[model samples]
Target: MLIRDLPYADPGVPDVRSGRHFLLWLGRRQLRGQAKSLAWGTLHMASVASIPIAVGLAVQAVVDRSGGGLALAGALLALLGLGATVGDTMLHRTAVTNWITAAARVQQLLARRTAELGATLTQRVAAGEVVAVSTGDIEKIGWCVESVSRFSAALVVALSVCVGLVVYEPELGLLVAAGLLLLIAVVLPLLPRATRRADLQREKAGRATELAADTVAGLRVLRGIGGEELFLRRYRSASQEVRQAAVRTARMWALIEAVQVALPGLLLIAVVWHGTGLAMDGRITVGELTTVYGAVTFLLFPLRLVQEFAMAYSFSRPSAARAARVLGLRRSGDGAGVGDGAGGGEARSLENPAEGDLHDPAGGLLAPAGRLTAVVCGDPDEAGRLAARLGGHDPSAEEDPAEEEGERPDARERALPSVLLGGVPLDAVPLEKARAAVLVQDKDPVLLSGTLRELLDVPGSGRVSANEALAAAQCADVLDALAQGTPGLNGDPLEARITERGRSLSGGQRQRLALARSLVTDPPVLVLDEPTSAVDSHTEARIAGALRRVRAGRTTVVLASSPLLLDCADQVVLLQDGRVTAAGTHRGLLRDDPHYRAVVTRETDDELAEGTTHA
Candidate 1:
């Protein structure tokens, strides 16, 4: 497919058998492009090889004093030069297309997998490794995939030229073939050392990248706790380690390059010496000597291509393996199947339940549609996991090897958790539909850089307008905060541009802004975790009041123990030790269930001092 037709509608399932297999799969996917590149590369190298041959023919004609033959040779040389130029241009164009398209395909696949696995991917794979795959590894893979055709062409033309020389004059031709073989022998042995060095460099670089990402992400926290210098020093040490590794890699490659150049020079000398001897001994003509010398010199171009192929393959193999490992990762439901539900058959046909209740069979909790439900749990982590499951994350999902090539993904008894929506398992629901049906706002939601309007713009039900969402989220002052920091945007608060991750906004402001954005989406089911923890109690109370009014008669699941939020819910459920312990109105739970009150209010000292008694 052309570059414009990218982001392949399917991106197809990847082959995760091994790193080498994954790379081979990538090449096979872009067959048409590779074919075009190979054709162009063949034309280019063949045309280049013809140039020296034409010059040698002209030299022979001139020596024989044949004016007609000399004139014919001149025209042939010009034609060969033009062909070389055009072929090289087209070859480069096709190769670049192959590179970009391959990279794009991998990037799209990664994005799709990311959405499928969601937050759990970060839990299974190191953040640094993921970054390296997306950044450095992607380029390496693309480079290797695109280089294959060119290297093939080089090998073909190199062999053809050698065969021609051998047939024309056995003496000089055999000498040239032997010299080429010797060059290959010497270069092949140095590759393993270079490969090891390259792998070391990539490892160190990945560690450094991870360190830098961590330091930057925590810069705000580091500065607050006076730990900025400590991290900076640590990063410096990591950076130096990476530098040393890189230098070692460069040294190995340099030695290889030196050998490459030195061997080719010696080969050219040997061919000239042998051809001169043959010409003087009446075994070859002066013109034949010219041709043999020219061919040997030109053969170096293809030999260098071989070296390039070797280096590219060594570096890309590990990268492909890493990408394969990531692609192979499947949700725990694919194998663990802890809570089976109809073999995930219902996932594809799911839609907004409209009035269906959300049921958690394992916990025996059912949240009726069109009601505000608050979930309280003693552990924040447990609450977070519940929220994730509620948002269609397979509770039993864990990363494992994806099905091998030629294996149907459907063959696996992929059983999702029995967390059902309208009797259909949430995990079984197709991700696109699941995302649309349920909205989960995490405790630490990230705000990407953009205008306020752009941030709020999402594929929403459109039932809740921007201003209404902002009001319900208690984000009135957030507009003022944006205006004060940004210039010339006071006229329209929506136009105010926020910096990366909303760095300019305070924790409370960022939280409210994210909450407002979430509200604007107006999904069929809304699930929030600690939505107002960063805000003051007063602001939290305002949000509670507006939240109930704006989201009236809608399915809202608030996973928090905040008294204000719980009191505002139509029904409150106490989730203890990963099970439903109590379910009732917030006030009823506080008055009747001592355990519920202990979790909601943290069992404060005043209650203990009074020695509050409960039946």
Candidate 2:
């Protein structure tokens, strides 16, 4: 396959039956490339092997003072050099092609899975592990894939050379074959220890990566409490552990490498010593002895390739297992999903998501179709939780046995608990379809760094234009924020380049921009949690009015306690202790429900104290 054909049209659902299976599947996926690599590798090694034979022919020809034989040897040597050049060049080209293509396929599959899983992927897979997999693990997997052909070619050529030697000069050939076997016997036992050390080093390194990622993500919080030093100490400790583990692994591999080098050297020495005796005894000529020595040296390269294959496999096995874990996350409307992540066959589409009300059986909350519903909870966290459920997700599923352990026996047979959309289980529906049907905007939505136009470029019903959505979300000031001395923006706020995570914008601007992005999507159902928490009361009032007018006939669930927003809702529900205690018009709830009033008012300290004194 050409580099242009990378990221397969259908990276073909991997056989994640096991890590071993996944790697095998990668091999099978690029069978034609593998075969080409094998062919070229064999040719390359074969050409190199013939060089020693030609050298021996030349020596013998010169010893016999035969000009014709010498000329033939020179011609053959030139031909062998040409073959070697072509073979080696082609081998490297094919191997690199295989590496890049395989890596691209893997990266695409990962991106697809990430998009499929959405926010839940990070909850299940540690940030550090995800980073490691994306950055480092893919390369290891590519190495594993490319090594198979190289190793096979090396083995075949090594065996052929041994056979040729045995026939050419039986005594010397027998000695060479025995030495090769002895070398194998020596390296075989060292692999297990070396592999163990490598695994240990990998595990420590992963832990260090996780610690560093956590520290960076929470750097603000850590600094607020003067805990930066604490985390720094922790990171240093983890890093030192990684260093120690690496050193141990290095020593073990060093032992193996030394054995590889020393044993081969000993074998070369023994071959030369034995061949010299044969030459003296007239069993083999001086030129034949030279040929034997050269052949022994050629075997060294193939032998090293064998070790390379082993090292590649050992390093990639863990990475494959981690990748398998990520690919296995299934969609569940129950907060966190647990199943074979890939929807079996084609995932069913949502026929009519807006045709029915969204009901949360546990909390007795219902957001009706073609209307705006406001849910107020005393606890902000409770509102966030309700929002996740409304959109058909369960964060609690992070506790799933399959996710925790990376694999589970008999996980595929279990049925998924789902959120109902139009009286249909959302888990049974495809992720892309379900997401398009119901959009969930979290309380703290993140803004991706990009041009303002790029941010609003989302799949939507197209009923709401970007300018309209931005206006409705009260993002006029946000537009100014985007255009603030930004370089390469073409003097258009829409072309402004926001910093990563939109850090260049104020908290309120970022919130409004995120809200505008959500509004632009214009899904059939929208679950927005505290969409205006960062803005002032005036902006919040305006957004609440605009939201109601813009989404007049679309289902919108706003989980917020702001009185202005609640007053604008067609239906306001008061939730208490994780249950819907009351539901009615905002004014009616305020008049009749003391708990609702208390939550909505968000009493000042003095007012609460006066009320307590009166009580």
User: Where in model 2 is the C-alpha error above 4 Å?
Assistant: 218-227, 333-352, 360-365, 375-389, 392-416, 485-497, 536-538, 561-568, 572-615
Clashes of 1: 3
Cα RMSD to the true fold for all candidates: 4.5, 4.8
The residue-by-residue lDDT of candidate 2 on 295-413, one tens digit each, is: 99999999899889988888888778777767666555322232225443222224556767777766778888889999999888777666766676654444343443344543424
* Model 1 clashing residue pairs (backbone): 332-397, 332-398, 347-428
Error of 1 at 169 (Å): 2.5
Clashing pairs in 2: 329-341, 330-341, 334-394, 335-393, 335-394, 335-395, 336-394
Q: Please, what's the RMSD in Å of model 1?
A: 4.5
lDDT of 1 at 156: 93
What's the count of clashing pairs in each model shown?
3, 7
Q: Can you give the lDDT of residue 610 in candidate 2?
A: 76
lDDT of each: 0.82, 0.82
